[model samples]
Target chain A: MTLCRYWRLDRHPEGNTRFERFLSLHEEACAPLAPGEVRIAVEWLSMDAGTRMWMSPRTDGYQPPLPLGSRMVGLVLGRVIESLDPAYPPGVRVRGFGQWADVATVVPALAGLEVVDETVADPRQHFGALGMNAWTALVGVREVAAVRPGEWLAVSAAAGATGSLACQIGRNLGARVVGIAGGAEKCRFLLDELGVDMAIDYRAEDVSARLSQVPGGVHAFFDNVGGPILDAVLGNMAHYGRVAICGMIAGYDSDVAMPGPAKFDQVLMRRLRIEGFFIPDFLERGAEFLPQLRTWLDEGRLAVRFDETQGLENVPAAYERMLTGRNIGKVIVRL
Target chain B: MTLCRYWRLDRHPEGNTRFERFLSLHEEACAPLAPGEVRIAVEWLSMDAGTRMWMSPRTDGYQPPLPLGSRMVGLVLGRVIESLDPAYPPGVRVRGFGQWADVATVVPALAGLEVVDETVADPRQHFGALGMNAWTALVGVREVAAVRPGEWLAVSAAAGATGSLACQIGRNLGARVVGIAGGAEKCRFLLDELGVDMAIDYRAEDVSARLSQVPGGVHAFFDNVGGPILDAVLGNMAHYGRVAICGMIAGYDSDVAMPGPAKFDQVLMRRLRIEGFFIPDFLERGAEFLPQLRTWLDEGRLAVRFDETQGLENVPAAYERMLTGRNIGKVIVRL
Candidate 1:
């Protein structure tokens, strides 16, 4: 029997600072695949902000809380090692919601497993340019926020996975992009790497003041961090502006509900719109989204900077880095 | 010269309770109509929650705040007494943004002036079933909130002008309507008069608790009173629910920005949509909407309960009565 080592939830975390105390690295024998089950040798684990909500004890989150002593679940980019499902046969490069384990087993249907294109030069593009983040960024910038050509699009948490992709997508669509991220380094990453029109260092600069300089105010906002950053964007939004909420990483650590934006009155005052969207809801439309994502990737337009942490044991550290915004791009654990 | 008696805004109001401290009644000779201007012998004044925001010194409101010492502006239904613009010929029953006066003058185009239909059985329907309130309700419920048939629709300030109309509109579309008002009398009015499926006395009963009784949670929320009531609704909203903000009378009295809803995170957690809309933005489409509104009115499906207060001298009292929720249905000053 193969040994499957994974991180397990010991308890619900209190905050971002002390994730180690609430999770422990554990090991188990890999069981034989059940009917319609697929086994994966998890090559890399994608650290996402939304799943952080599921780790909390809150029952009202997007999904149920992860039970104590359960294998920590996350998106894994890997090759199928063994499978009972004929549709997902052995040796196919796949991506889905899997455990933080070197060896992970999942029911293909429930885990949103999909066979990725193997002909791509870089297989990591499954977790990068052509992944869920790219899909989310496309849908958010193009459809939800409806960023039109020559419109000003503001993206919060702009140096991170989805936000960075969104910044590039906005620029690609001929919209002027303003990327809001913490620290001078992330701001530089947004400006130089993502080629955003404006980069606001949310930590050092006055975000609202910086945004106020944009003529006619921000027309479309793709938001990831949703606490004070959301309020900052709201107050500076143009009349009839659209806000697409992708993540609320600011309140991901806590079980308690996050307070809504302090400038919520702007919704009425400015005729603004705020819509919340999840990418998983659009999984069935992946084929439709993938071509555009691949075209951008092939043209070297969609650049993704991965902040990788080596080893399965480092998933918790990587997760903390992602949640705390210390990582400059997509935070991932290479198992 | 026609001596026009009107109310003047001397200073911004600190709160709703004491409008007398800020505004005072005054009389001036009605000025001759300028090029493109028209004068009205005001017969009635419509008190709306939105204009209350205009009474403050908020520079960033839906429009520039009414200048201090200027005439208090509101919707007026009357016969054109004089005109320089042929579009508003004398003796035509017209409706537009006119002053709170016995005689008022306006630049027809800027005032949203339109020669109203005189064939209706009750001319009050110009400020009632075929009025801005009806248009607001139709657009808000049908387009903004996008309430589908057989869905549950919750309306705040349900006994008031726009809210009462919205409740009936939702029911007319075959959606279940829950009316939330301040007291038992308003609750009874909502249930007995408006025929809402449920009526919650917001001052007595728990707004969120009453909303929780909805089977799949509130699918569409037409909110006028923002603040705790908005927060309550936000928390109990169904996944993919729509919130159409028509008014925020809760914060109308103060110039200070009102706090955003505390339960705002639900916007992300519930995948909900929140939109703010103004009726003036839709005035150009009034003719397109008049047919359905007229049909509903003729069928007795769209009933407007007028809480009428007579005389322009009592405009301050009537404004107070409307703002304080002391009146059920549309509040109007019949001159």
Candidate 2:
């Protein structure tokens, strides 16, 4: 019998609380799967700021909160240890929405797990730019907000996984890309590593002042942080601008209502548009994106950065670093 | 020379200044025009809440405040008394962006004034239902928000000119029309007169509670009054709802910054779309709305209402009544 551990939140806090009593890992013995089910031995787990949101009840139509004594729901790379389903046999690698635990039993359709294709150049690319992260960025840009090429695109949380991909994709489409991040290092990485045209360290520079550097104001804004940064983008948006609101990372961990100076007058006055999206929705359109993504990767047109953490025990620490903006690219825990 | 009287605001007020003190009407000789110009004897002037917006600095992209003592900029209907241009011969009636004066001069292109067409019905229809106000409503519904038939369509200031027309047009398109107003009288007008599905008197019942009675959340919202009412709409907006913001007459007169209760979270969570629009941009599509409007009017499918205030001297008092929501339908000052 193999011991599988699951991480669950004990209490929702007002701020980041990784080392605190909130997160606890409980161990259990692996059990046999039901008919037509498969047990995956988790290999890599994707850590995003959205993981913090599962701590509280979903404010809107999003999925319900993670139960107190249950494992956290997240994306993971894994191998099928045992399968009652013929399609996914033992030793086959796959990607799916799974728990932070080492082993999970799920039906093939519900898990959204796809058998890894060997023809793909880099299988790890499934967890990074050519995978879920890239799909999300593209969905936010194309489907949610419907951003057109040659427009000015501004993304908040610029150096992180989703933001980094959004910046590069905006550049690839001939758009002027501007990024906003917390620290100078992330901002520098956004400009130097990700090829973002302008990077604003919200901790250092005034967002509204540097907005003038864009000249025509932002035509499209990809927002990850949803407090003062969202408010600031509303002010600088051009007439008929579209804002792709991917996540409210800044407000996720907070137990209280996030407050910031706001001006909705600009929303009506400038005739702006804002929308939110999740990556899973892209699955319906996955066949369309996967081919283009593979081509972009093969042609060296796509670039991705990863801040990989080794071992399942270090997943908690990686979550902390990602929340604090310490990681440069996609934060992944390798088991 | 014909004497032309013009009303001007001598000084900008920091707060609500009584009309008796701030406004002054002075008479001057009707100046003759140069080539390609026509002299129009003003017949009626529109004195809606939009006039109050002209008192401040040009923040909303309208022209600068009327030069200290010059006439106000607004829509007025007039008859061509003298013509320096062949296009506008004497006795032809026209509409132009002229003002409080008895007579004004304009270039041929600016003289929107044409002989009132006698082909169909009531001449007053041209200024209210079959004119710019109706055209604006159609544009707000079809173009900006893109309201589909059988959708829930709600409008604020429902008995007013724009709102009243909006309800009829939305209903004509098979929408379930709901309206919000300040009193029972206007509420009655919305249902019995304008043919809306339901009407909510904000002074009587809870707006939020009444919205629950709506089968599903509204699909298209036509907002003229922006304040707490806008907040109420934001809370109950359907998934992927479209909010067409036409005017903020509710907050236009306030001197202090009236930022409607912060609800950016709703815009993101609900994937709601909010857009502001002007009729000028839709003029190209204006003619397209007229034939349909005329059909609705001729077939007795449309209702037209006006709050007519006679004489130029009553413009200030008439404006005061409009600001107070005393007028139901277009507030017109007849000469």
* Highest lDDT against the true fold, candidate: 1
Could you estimate the TM-score for every candidate? 0.99, 0.93
Q: What lDDT tens digits, residue by residue, belong to model 1 across residues A69-111?
A: 8988999989898999999989998999999889889999999
Proportion of true contacts reproduced by candidate 2:
0.32
- Runs of candidate 2 exceeding 4 Å displacement: A58-61, A84-87, A143-145, A256-261, B13-17, B58-67, B84-86, B107-116, B255-257
| DockQ of every candidate | 0.86, 0.42
Give the lDDT of residue B259 in candidate 1: 87
On TM-score, the candidate that comes out on top is 1
What CAPRI class is candidate 1?
high
Q: Tell me the deviation in Å of residue A214 in model 1.
A: 0.4
| Residue lDDT tens for model 2, B233-280 | 777788778888888876566543356445546665667777777676
